[model samples]
Target: MAQPTTSILCTDLGFDWPDGTTVLDGFHLAVGPGRTGLIGLNGAGKSTLLRLLAGELTPASGTVRVGGELGYLPQDLTLDTTQRVDEALGIRAAREALHAIESGDTDERHYAAVGDDWDVEERARATLDRLGLARLDLDRTTGELSGGEAVLLHLAALLLRRPDVLLLDEPTNNLDRHARSLLYEAVASWHGVMVIVSHDRELLQHVDQIADLRAGSVTWYGGNFADYERTVAAQQETAERLVRVAEADVQRQKRDLIEARTKLERSASYGKKRSESRNDPKIISGKLKRQAQETAGRVRGMHTERLTEAKERLTAAEEAVRDDAEIRIDLPRTAVPAGRTVLNLDHVRLPYGTRAHLELRGPERVALVGRNGSGKSTLLRAVAGEIGPLEGEISTPVPLRHLPQRLDLLDDGLTVVGNVKSYAPAADDNAIRARLARFQFRGGRADQLAGTLSGGERFRATLAALLLADPPPQLLMLDEPTNNLDLASVRQLTQALAAYRGALIVASHDLPFLRGLGITRWLELDGELRTIDPM
Candidate 1:
């Protein structure tokens, strides 16, 4: 394929805050055809630069240029709750198209400005049918559609806009494996310049290029995330070398300055004695003063130069590992087993106003997998003792840790630190901070409101609180622990669980995660829990 012209180009872009803090200076970037993954840590200005490209944010100075029409999908979309799935895209349009098709009217001259297509309704239905929106009821509420389905509808709407440039932020965030695959298929097949800014490594690998944002600059690494990793590794080594050399130079300068200052002090004392002596020479004292002043000036200049160099080196260090990729966080899993029979329900039904009964027991890595609305979550609540069984004796351990799927247990009003402290008030503040640090929550992030934390951070905080309890619980009940975690966190958590000795009864649809964690037993909702082969 021919290399299309640059979709967006930024030259010598400079932006600063009202408080005079510089966010970017001398930043330059160019985006082109192919899948380009834009990566950075939480606050490394990735989103800001993307906004600059999308014309949402104006540069404080310099120029941002776009070459083509753009269609952008934000990281988080607040979709229409009242409109139907089909209607969300275009209600009256689809309805009229359906009516026209039924009446066999194939005239396009009536609306010649939109398109020159011969049969307008035929074209509309064909597009909807291709996108799988043809069967959906025109009045089915958008809010009722699954997240993946809703996203597809948005894509169909964008198709109607006929954009030549597409930008996506964190696409595949809430999508399942199949849905994520479908999204990738759509992106790969698009005849446009696609630029996706996502942390999903799997998705990144599918892309043709990557633009890694660091230290107010964007560096392009061709051919996906793996290639980007190799490039970053080399760059980090070079940056570290420069930092060490600068540090050594700064230390040497400081020492020389200190020695020179000491000599000046001794010389001044000698000059004072000479003046007091009978044979004292006033000229000698004056010469001594000049010599000291010259040495001091030399030392001061060296110090100033070294300070500037040192500050630059520090910035390099900060930029080198902004997104270190080594996600630091461990979910604690104990080896101490819960006494046999962690959860048991004898002839009991679930969903007091609904249907189904459940029976369970103490088993490690029990999966409560089923279709949506299959009461898998309900069963977890019963096991957790959050809800009483309708007509059976339900038993469970008192010190069990539950990671709810919906995050309903988390109170969004509190800070991450505050939320953990709510359950472990007696725990030392220092200890709490240490726990947060283990989960990659550092700096002033502990001060950030829980209501504002990303989905992954909130879940980590909750998991840390539960796992850090003294006399660690024997039973671990996790409801979709992998829900919002990035790839790095998921891998780390998987390794952590492998080393954990405690019993795990998890509810998740991530089959690979379930299998990799060495699940020793399987629990199907409709049948008895049975032992499975452990890998």
Candidate 2:
């Protein structure tokens, strides 16, 4: 019944990159005990703000205060492969000390280490179990786990800390559906202050509030993502209406100004004619002319001022609208005939000894869905000819390209244009630049080094190169392509896919994304491929 307590606060926070690019300026936020989802377009500085709050990055100015201990899981996570689970959980030393005491070694140092945490092992196991890692052993090395399992283990360690404030950045990036469900459960059970930066709509649905970050400022929205969407849509409708009204007012004022000028011109002509005809005294005529001139000037100035104000109103109204561009390119060359066989797998022995047999015709779109460590990537690689299966006959009648989740297909040292050039050796420089522009890499942006690009930019660059390959690929395979993309980028990808007429084989855990792709077939890759209804 009581109001939740404030656990995080930032006042007049400011930060800028070393290149003098400002990200946040005079930012202010106060978060209480509840989950808050932070969302924004790519390059909106969401990660930057989280880093500042976690004390991982120093702010250029202003103060950040936390009411209690904090736990942070960054988007770019890297764990030491050789570290034991208990060590990663910050309890290995205590467990060892406890064991020594139980074995009749009563050293004071061991007793000190085991002071008040005699049940540490039990608590660790319980936390792991709660995270759906019940089968995992504390002594197991981190290298023995899958990528998604590693992410869950990291989250479990943070939960064991029991910090009052928790920060997560794209926590579901590597997690499978089951692991994502487990994470959602953990989030639902948390009573502390939680701030998560994620593009996952399902994850955002569990939050108590949404923090819309844009141009270095945060706007609060009550309720979940769907609620936020409805509210934002209403706002956009109002803004658009205002813009229309302002535009009309500007047109009206312009017409009035034109009429005023015409009247003034007529009055001046009449006055000159009267003076030339000598119809009245010179002084009286002059005085009459002066009054007419003054009236015309006032009317014209008034109309001009009204028009300027109307233009200003229109500008203000337009500012309220958001720009989320769609990819509208037509990939005609990528289209395949109805009877064309794009790919065929004849009793292929996939990784982990799973056998798969399939045939894809025309532009059939297949979505590969399954739990983590189910060999999705391995299968995709085999299809792309990046690797060969132990036993099988595979055939690809059309050019195929694979987009891996890591997006490591790009050369870090090369520019985007250079990468595209390598993929399309026959295309000239001007032609390459022109095509790159369609991918949102206009002019100088195409010159940026791949290593320095943000996640979304790198994805775009990779996509551009793949789509713009020398012969124009007729079949595309993507593995978790939306992993770290922002909402806008995901929409861009969806739009791009919608325009493609080629066959698609995409392996993704994001149901919304896969659905948006208009998948014609759903294939679950458990140990082997099996056709199933779409999720």
Weakest 10 consecutive residues of candidate 1 by summed lDDT: 526-535
Error of 2 at 251 (Å): 2.6
Task: Give the per-residue Cα lDDT of candidate 2 at 197.
Answer: 96
Q: Which candidate comes out best when scored by TM-score?
A: 2
Q: List residue ranges in candidate 2 displaced over 4 A.
A: 1-6, 106-108, 279-289, 409-438, 441-452
Clashes of 2: 0
CA lDDT, every model vs. true structure: 0.67, 0.90
Model 1: which residue pairs collide? Answer: 334-502, 335-501, 415-450
Where does candidate 2 clash, by residue pair? none
What ranges in model 1 sit over 4 Å off? Answer: 1-6, 9-29, 43-69, 74-144, 160-162, 214-217, 241-319, 323-335, 338-382, 387-395, 405-417, 437-463, 469-535
**TM-score (C-alpha) between model 2 and the true structure:** 0.92
Residue-wise lDDT of candidate 1 within 391-421, one digit each (tens)? 6676665367777867666678877777778
Each prediction's TM-score against the native?
0.70, 0.92
